[model samples]
Target: MSFLLTSCSTYPVEVTSADQLAGVWEDFAGRTVEFKGDGTFTATGMDEADVGEECSGVAATQQGALSLSGTYADVTFDGVDCEGMMLAFYGSPSSFVVCFTRDVTAGGCTGELSRKDDVTATGRHE
Candidate 1:
């Protein structure tokens, strides 16, 4: 007799640079960010536990390469001023993660984004 088995593997890649990363990327936590490919991005629904409550829905347009090792941008709403950084967390490659400099939370990093893309029947994106 013989038996057959199946398996799948997940090898997520890290976003090393902020180049060519365009399109509307949505996280499992309902946060969304639209990268315009010009070092300026527009986002909405960013006031989550992972994301910063200080700023949301309004992002500042800056001129320069927004990289993990370079200049960060402002994502303040209603003319508010707060520095926000976008990068793949050193621990892992996180999607749509926005690290703020003024977040009251520890480390000031947003942990809402997820890699799970399937929407289950329970209405949960997990």
Candidate 2:
């Protein structure tokens, strides 16, 4: 008799709108975060050791039949005192959040994306 093992594959499920991510968000350290609708976001700053190295790239957000993507610059957090950059993504009519981090070395960004009243996705950006 022979036995075989099967692997499972999982794809990322995309959230359609920024309205799905409305709420007061908190980082792993319990810091309050605010994501604006007009493609603006604010977070308590973190440290260089906390955020890691800088990251340069682009990100996109899609709503219904509309999609927007753009290049982003590096920005350190405001209050947390971390050495990282602020990354913004546009979604929905006026929904967007700014992500701040040096790199994906640590657990990742403290904030997350949410839908309705539940966490749709959580993790650091690579």
**Native-referenced Cα lDDT, model 2:** 0.32
lDDT of 1 by residue, 19-116 (tens): 63455545545556665566555565554333344434333422223444332343333444435633432122433333334422233233433323
Candidate 2 minimal-lDDT segment of 10 residues? 1-10
- Model 2, residue 12: C-alpha shift (Å): 2.5
- In lDDT terms, which candidate is top? 1
